[model samples]
Target: MSHTLLSSPLQGFTDFKFRNAFNHFFGGIDTFYAPYIRLNGKMVIKNSYKRDIALENNTELEVIPQIITNDVDEFLFVSKYIRELGYKELNWNLGCPYPMVTKRGMGSGLIHDSKKIDSILHRVHNESDVLVSMKMRMGYENPEEILDTLPILDKYPLKNIAIHARIGKQLYKGGTDLGAFQKCLDNTKHKMYYNGDITSVAAFKELQERFPSIDHWMIGRGLIADPFLPSMIKNNTTEYPKNKIDIFSEFHDRIFKEYDAALSGPTPIRMKMLGFWEYFSQSFENPQKTYKKIKKAKSVKNYTIAVREILKEAKR
Candidate 1:
């Protein structure tokens, strides 16, 4: 059976190419939520955002577009536009812990102002027909924020709420604080999807044992660090698909080729590859060497050479 506990968007890491490549070869995630489309307070969608999750060439997989916005009108405009593009669901990102976004009273910061959040959600719920979902954190500055804010979130009646199980201040550091997640489960009425630290088979089994009632799980960095994590989570085994190293390497190459063809210049290409290396190297036995060589590569040719070396070592 197809499994739904799978890859979630990781901004720069989970673009269309990565999603398509991962789904085709690695075989885990059933549905992917692309990184939040940041509209620059303008009416038009930016080219980069459009290119990230277009319903074009990426029709091979089920992909949902996520939007990050504080304005109701802008959100509605974009959400409706995506719906026209054949999307049945739209995800609102309220869990981004970045200062740049949170300071604007958007992302995790929105959780702080329950009244404003209710007003925005009230409008979106009443006005929009296409199902709306939210991915959020416990709060902006404190883990206890969800204790009260969850009630406000419940008032909106979202299709589902995915909680990251960390506060904004944590910013992906420290543990997931399962006690806080339990508190959310105790207090919130909305359907909840757990998102955080479910990286390995053992970890997933632990999560399942702890929260047997939760059927939905969202994986972000874990999926990138180990492409097979989702499949392992579903199978409940430590064993991964055989020849994982080779298949994963080819998938990365395919994404690199796609990026090389689509990106405008060498700098952009290098930047993208750098971002990939952040997690990609971790999968390798010689991750430190692999990442260091790639990070220090002076040109495309040299970078390719370093990759080939890593592949050779990986094969042995």
Candidate 2:
């Protein structure tokens, strides 16, 4: 059996444009997880969400649509919507840690209540035949929260279960608890995918050694921080592409151009690229300096110059 590499979706960052551009430029991820589509207090699925999963927009990559909600109705609506678009799989995002989402008893917050999960899963599975997978944290308030939820989950014929080792409240702050994850490995019989803190090849190798049984891996911020990581892990090499910087430049330019055309002013475009630089700069030598310059660039022309300079520094 071979290892499977998956791209974990980041809400603001992993839209179709980014997924398409990343696939075109880097091409390591076996499947791209689109950001979770929510009803946003309405019953309608937004056009923006539809565009992200549109088959025509994502021709270059195998993409999975993720839906975030604790409501049975919302889940069913998204299920029918995507099935109409011809998608076979729908990923439930029970793992989002943000306060705004969790405050409403959604995302990781819902993981605490087994009964709620049981109700939601029962209705969605019975009402529609849409294949459902889940991406989640260990718990919202405690590591043991997942222990209680797994039995409820096991009752369902879920396609997959991807677990981020940290609890929701930790929110990417602390190291992943592999020990707790080991407990998860012991408890659940479902096919599992390990996620969180796999930023380096060495780290991934270490986890691979620790959990030889878990072949599926979901990468989120780490992929954003280092786009070449999946390729490195897949090929089992420390060496990066010789033209990595060049590839990154093309990737950045394409995303920039796309956002530039869609967005209104220099400010929105600059702000959008700045959000990417928050991660992309970490892949470079002088990350702080690189990010500072990019962050300070007021105009798009200046932002372009900053990027050029960063590329030059990367070459050196």
Best by TM-score: 2
Mark the 10 consecutive residues where model 1 has the least summed lDDT: 1-10
Runs of candidate 2 exceeding 4 Å displacement: none
All candidates: CA RMSD in angstroms? 1.7, 0.9
lDDT of each: 0.83, 0.92
TM-score of 2: 0.98
Model 1 Cα lDDT, one tens digit per residue, 54-152: 778578888878888888888888878888888888898989999999999888988878887777778887887768888999898887877777888
Superposed on all Cα atoms, model 2 deviates from the true structure by an RMSD in Å of 0.9
* TM-score per candidate: 0.95, 0.98
- The candidate that wins on lDDT is 2
lDDT for predicted candidate 2 compared with the true structure: 0.92
Candidate 2 local lDDT, residue 121 = 94
